[model samples]
Target: MLRARPKGRPKATDVELVDVVVGAPDAGHVRVENLVMSVEPYMRGRMGGEATYAEPYPIGEPMLAPTVGRVTASADDTVPVGALVLHERGWREHALVPASECRIVAHDDLPPVVHLGLLGIPGMTAWIGAERIARIETGDVVFVSSAAGAVGSTVVQIAKLRGATVIASAGSREKAALARDLGADIAFDYHDGRVTDLLRDALAQVGASGLDVYFDNVGGDHLEAAIRVINDHARIALCGMISIYNAETPLPGPSNLIKLIWRRARMEGFLLRDHLDARGEFEAQMATWIRMGAIRPVHTEFAGGVAGAWDAFLGMLDGTATGKAVVPLGTLGAGTHGGNDSLDKEANR
Candidate 1:
């Protein structure tokens, strides 16, 4: 529970992890021992106390996030005891989840963490952005922004799998190299210069036509660049605008947005929750890609329980951890600290 809402950047003191004892589950409810908890960029918007296709996190309440766990006890037959499941009542070691909100996903071949990263929202998000939103095609020239992050990196591999020429952008040279290692045909650092010029030159170097599709994860400068060089009828999947996630107010709009009209291009934003209708198909295809070594899950795992959640979340907000930020909430990892009051006082400063 937050003692008070944040004034600027959030602090460890703003959040306190209170213990909630989990008694036996009621009928139709399953008690789960959480294994892995997810911390993503969207949670930052939730903490801002404004609704953006979602509601604000209520103060003095147990925080909510997608969690993968094992059913220690079950009151419903569909979710039997000892089955692994995914639920949204994370932020803690144990949770009582409604059977409807919990999905059984116990597979010995695939670890539970995969269900939270590549095989989960991040992977599905990339697939939706490419196939559904951007409509990537064979022989198409594609550009992905924030290409070192979870979703953008997955977008790179998925584009390669679909036989498209993948152009990936990262914030630093090291990240750009990682993008190239992940099969991006061309990887450039967005910080090098105006990304517009870089995209144009990279296209020339590769002897490819202008971008046919753009998997846009960084919106400000990257969006402008993509709009500037996009081919006629090119489509853009507006996945995120992380460059401005911390801005106090609206920043400047892309100067080249008019290119959308000039080139007859299309840009659309999407949330993976709205596209779950494709989950069954995405899961099967993603499994195949994994078996064929087409897609690799990239993420950072923080080995602290719920007590470390506030710090782990802060680390993600500061861009310290690459890919998806995951915290392993083992039973022992949970009981190490009392709450934010126990956090290193220096972290609060």
Candidate 2:
């Protein structure tokens, strides 16, 4: 649990590991042994003890996040023992949760971790932004910021699959290369020079006059730059602002707000919780894409179970992890499930 609201950039001392008792579930609940949990950038906001899209994590209480596990004991017959389930009580080894909060993962062939990454909130956010909000079309020139991260990587692939030319930006050369490998037409490191200059050069290289769609994961400089070169009636989807997630004080807005009026462009911010109606469709389409090798899920896994989740979260915010950062707690045998074996091999190298 968080010691208190962070004063500035959060530190390891803000959270501590304490022993707790796990009691058996009541009539409509089950006891889950968590197998894997997701660590994402948005979680940083929750720790600030301020209201946002989601409720703030109370001080001195266990943090919650999307988790995948198996039901070890169940009081509800509908959710049988040993059934794989997805819930939102992570940062712990065992969670006693209502059966209604558990979503059974029907696909037995895929790795349990998949439920916390590509097929989870991150992937769904990308899908909704690209397909519904941005409405990316063939021939459209799209710009995706933080293009090597979890949501941005998925947005890059979805734009390419829709026949849009993609311009990707990342923090480092290695991550930039990753964006290109994932099918971006041009990928650049944001640390190279001014973001505006880099974006202009990328657009010129692709022979695009201006951006048709912008998927923003990193705000601040990236948002300002995208606004500077937007085409007439362009669309921008505000997925996240990882660049300022750890700021101590309020940051300045983009200086180009007037450009939206001049360009007749539309920019909208979204939350995945509001779009739950589309989850079934998104999951089905993504599953097909995965099986056909049209889309790949990218993530970095930490091995020390629940205790490692904090480090994984910190690493993600510090830009140390390439894609999604995940913590696996249980032993799910290899080759029995569908995970990215090629990425594992590359990590070993």
Candidate 3:
């Protein structure tokens, strides 16, 4: 049971928290004590009544995402009672879920949060886009938008692993520098005037005619520039368009899409849900890379109880969060539940 409404964006709907009890696990069901909650842009879409990759959050319904939790009880013998699992539990202290919906996580040296991030959706999205959609190869000039964000950063690392020369874009100069530090051959500030000119120079600096593959995250203008700068027979993985996400009005199609016809470029868009069946294989590969120190996971954590979950979610919507924004309910934030309350109070003073 919880005491108050979940904190989130001003525009957020379907937000609340209060008295709830977990029932004993039934056949194929497992009860979990959630330890970490993943705050992501897709969740924001659900809050806004926006129809993106999934359905909008129903009013008064509990919001859910990929959460790491400890199994307190299990009805299914296949899932042990003490195992750690990741399931589509919401911003709550506990959950009861189906056994098939959860995956056991066993990487001890790696932080459990990585299972919500690098070793999870962000990592897999980058891997599939680079390996399958874009078909990244040695000597290929790959351009990635939102290079400093979770999925974008993962793409940069995996593309580098594939021996491709990487060019990345970020909204700020500081983020651009961070991308460069993360092995990007070139980094550009997207907020600067004349993005196309800036990108042309980046391509020219690399002694390339045009980009062979593009990992797109910011789709509007960035997509426009990419269309103009792609080589013949290029490939593009349309990840997401954060720029148009908040627009009250509808967005127009890419103006430079004609390049696709002229250059015979292949462009495709994907949703993470489509790849859920292959979670085991993706986890195996990502865990190896994380354990090998070949990849680094970054996150911005917001310390707040269940009440703070709403605010942390809205923070991501406002572009205030750098990496993954998370809320550790019951342990941090405005509520006084335990030892975490003292830290929250002292910080306030």
Candidate with the greatest TM-score versus the true structure = 2
Model 1: lDDT of residue 224: 80
Q: TM-scores, in order shown?
A: 0.92, 0.93, 0.87
What is candidate 2's local distance difference test score? 0.87
- For model 2 the local lDDT of residue 159 reads 98
- Report the poorest 10 consecutive residues by lDDT, candidate 1: 340-349
User: For candidate 1, lDDT tens digit of each residue in 7-98?
Assistant: 56787878886654567899999988888889888887777777787787888877788889889888998998888888889887777899
Q: What's the residue-level lDDT of 116 in candidate 3?
A: 77
lDDT of each: 0.82, 0.87, 0.77
Query: Where does the lowest 10-residue lDDT sum fall in candidate 3?
Result: 340-349
Off by over 4 Å in 1: 106-108, 331-349
Best by lDDT: 2
Q: Residue 86 CA error for candidate 3 (Å)?
A: 0.2
Q: Rank the candidates by lDDT, best first.
A: 2, 1, 3
Q: lDDT per residue, candidate 2, 152-246, as tens digits?
A: 99999999999999999999999999999999999999999999999999999999999999999989999999999999999999999988888
| Clash pairs (backbone) in predicted model 2 | none
lDDT of 3 by residue, 1-349 (tens): 1222323334444454454545678899998877778777776566655465687666666777778878888999878898989888857766788999988885845776787788767777888788777889998999999888878888888888889899999878887887888889999887786779889989888888899998998788889888998999999999888877666677887888889999999999987778777677777888888888888786777776566677777777666666566666543334523333222133221
